[model samples]
Target: NLRVHLLEVEESVDRVFSDDSTKKAVNLLYMYPNGVNTVSSDIQGLTESSTNLGVVTTLENSIEYDSTARSS
Candidate 1:
């Protein structure tokens, strides 16, 4: 189940980053102070929607998934 969740996160990240609607390149670093790293992405452009920040929203959702998985 954990593996499946992780795969889902991977796919979500890939899909969001690969989207062509994004305009400015950005990097997302998912790291822990304890030196544990889960996921990171250095990709080109974020979505152009000013009111709807797609990257941030997606990352937040990803973090929620991570938290839920951790608790389980």
Candidate 2:
């Protein structure tokens, strides 16, 4: 439910996967944050894993409520 938690999760995933471990990295990177925001928060430190990461975040929130760079 916190950014720190998200960062922890990201780092944990990063630690276990090697450069060649694309699938594992992608799966970890695709994980959604715990809280919902009216204006989507910036998701940093994550590699481009799922092609629909942005899309999934959008649909979960709403066009007006969802902008990856915008904060709650």
Candidate 3:
């Protein structure tokens, strides 16, 4: 039950960030697809500062990850 709730919250955060008018928040928690967790935001102004550049994979799953960056 707790995991499901957290997943919903993660989705909500994704939606909020996708909005163009939304201001950057101080924190973000992503529940990776395989179950691992991550914290991130584009506030640092990296060259690739967007959700596409900030995803982390869940180590327990075998799904293919497209990003070339190493998964944390």
Candidate 4:
């Protein structure tokens, strides 16, 4: 299960990653969290900024951003 998701098959691994790279995949045992603090702080800042801007403006901005960033 995890092996397939991790691309344990040789051809699958080769197709996904460069042959010269040292690491092609990591097992659950090696997976670790490192960026939670930075992301949490950014989210808190967005919440505070949105509160100052009011909900209507924030929602309109979000809708405009989504429309601009997406294409048919």
Q: Which candidate do you rate higher for TM-score, 2 or 3?
A: 2
Model 1 quality (TM-score):
0.13
Off by over 4 Å in 3: 1-30, 33-48, 53-61, 68-72
Candidate 4, residue 31: lDDT? 46
The window of 10 residues in a row where model 2 has the poorest summed lDDT is: 58-67
Candidate maximizing TM-score? 2
Each model's lDDT: 0.28, 0.36, 0.31, 0.26
Q: Which candidate number has the best lDDT?
A: 2
Give the root-mean-square deviation of each candidate in angstroms.
17.1, 15.1, 16.0, 15.6
The residue-by-residue lDDT of candidate 2 on 1-72, one tens digit each, is 223233334333323334565464445554643233343236554343322224322232232222253232
Task: Please identify which of the two predictions, 3 or 4, would achieve the higher lDDT against the true structure.
Answer: 3
Better of 2 and 3 by lDDT: 2
Which residue pairs does candidate 2 place in steric collision? Answer: none
Ranking by lDDT: 2, 3, 1, 4
TM-score of each: 0.13, 0.20, 0.15, 0.16
Error of 1 at 4 (Å): 12
Evaluate residue 29 in candidate 2 and report its C-alpha lDDT on the 0 to 100 scale. Answer: 54
In model 1, where do residues sit more than 4 Å from their true spots?
1-5, 8-15, 19-26, 30-56, 59-72
lDDT of 1 by residue, 1-72 (tens): 012132334333334544433322222222312222243244334322222122234452242212212110
lDDT per residue (tens digit) for residues 1-72 in model 3: 123233334333322233432222212223323332343464343333222323434343222233333333
